[model samples]
Target: MDISLVAGLLALGAAVGFAAGMLGIGGGMLLVPFMTMLFTAKHFPQEHIVHMAIATSLATIMFTSISSVRAHHARRAVLWRVVKLLAPGILIGSWVGPWIGAQLNSSTLALAFAVFVAFSGTQMLLDKKPAAARELPPAPGMFAAGGVIGVLAGLVGAGGGFVSVPFMTWCNVKIHNAVATSAALGFPIALAGTLSNIYFGMKVPDLPASSLGFIYLPALLVISLASVSTAPLGARTAHSLPVKTLKKVFALLLYSLASYMLYKAFG
Candidate 1:
């Protein structure tokens, strides 16, 4: 790998890690479009770019989530019981989602990613609080919700925070608690998604060198290292900052990236 590329990936990872900690998004929403651009520049197989980007993005979250969650856990913000209830269904859904995504073509996947991200961003930007009477559901409902979050996250190569944060908040979880718990959930989402992507991608031919199934290994390593270093800082910042305002800013950034992805799918 070129030194310049490594440096670029490092910088990207730092930014992504901070975003992950601050927003509990696990950085995949930000990483995917950027990775797609990087892979394209490196002349990776065009048909496989989206898959590879998603896979690598998920893989990096494995590290970012751990570092971010540790910070949240230290702060006593993570709802361990919620995490426990949602995990089993999350694992199953995440494992299945990559398989389903593998059946789609690059254009279709890109289009889906674009649309999904736009919707998530819109939700964050609006920052609407749910009715006061609402509360988190029973165990069964939590599991079902986890399944949906996991499936959508796997499809988009995220850590499930895009959906999970909103879902928790709608259930009347405090915003900070929601973000913290979402960070914890990122681990399960990333693990299952990464394994599933690898399993499904092994059959695909003509992948780029230094690739592990759909994952671009070099990028994963470079990004993971930098991301872990910054995630704790982001988590600490999240505790002190105006996260709602930050979410609006981040949402704007998401809109821009989603537009680029839409162009990649069709143009």
Candidate 2:
């Protein structure tokens, strides 16, 4: 691997890990589009670029989420009951989502990613509290909600925090608990999605060297190295900062990313 690529991956990992810790996001949303650009610059096959990006992003999440979640769990913020309720459906939905995504062309997938990210950014920026802060719904409703979060996470290479954290908070869970629980949820989402992408992309053409299915080993290695060390720092920072301010900044960043992805997709 080139030194430049190594540097890029390290930088990306540092940024993503910090975001994951601070925002309770799995960081795949940032990882995906950025990796797409890197892969494109490397002259990876256009058809497989986005798929590789998504797969690699998910793979990285598996590690980063663990680090972030451990830090959050140390703070006693994770809601174990909620994580248990979400796991089954998150796994199923994440597994299925990649199969569906693999059927679409890269440009279409990019467009879809842009749309969802833009929407998520808008939601975070608005930061509207629900009319009523109520308890979580019944088992079935919670499970179904997990399914939705998983599907979107798989499709967009997120950790499901963008959806799940907000959902839990709206259900009257404390924001810290919601963020911590979302970090816990990222494990299943990343695992299921990563495995699905590996299987789905096995027959894909022209994947770059050092690639296992869609996960690029060099990038994964460097990124994981940087991210794992930084994640706990971010989790520590999260507890110290005003999350409202963090969310606003993160929301603006997401909007910028969404716009750039759209430009890349159409330009």
| Root-mean-square deviation (CA) per prediction | 1.1, 1.2
Question: What's the lDDT of the predicted structure labeled candidate 1?
Answer: 0.91
The most accurate candidate by TM-score is 1
Off by over 4 Å in 2: none
Local accuracy of candidate 2 as per-residue lDDT tens digits, 1-267: 889998999999999998888778898878988999999998989888888898889889999999999999999999999999989889999998888889988888888888988887788788877667477888898889989999988987889887887788778787778878998999999999999988988888778878988788888888888888888888888888786876786578778888977987798
Encode model 1's per-residue lDDT on 1-267: one tens digit a residue.
999889889999999999899889899988999999888998888999999999999999999999999999999999999999999989999998888889999999999989988887898788887899999899999999999988988998999888898788878898788889999999999999999999999999999888888999999999999999999999998888776766676578678878999999999
Model 1 regions more than 4 Å off: none
**What does the lDDT read for residue 57 in candidate 2?**
91
Best by lDDT: 1
lDDT of each: 0.91, 0.87
- In model 1, how many backbone clashes occur? 0
Error of 1 at 210 (Å): 1.5
TM-score of each: 0.97, 0.96
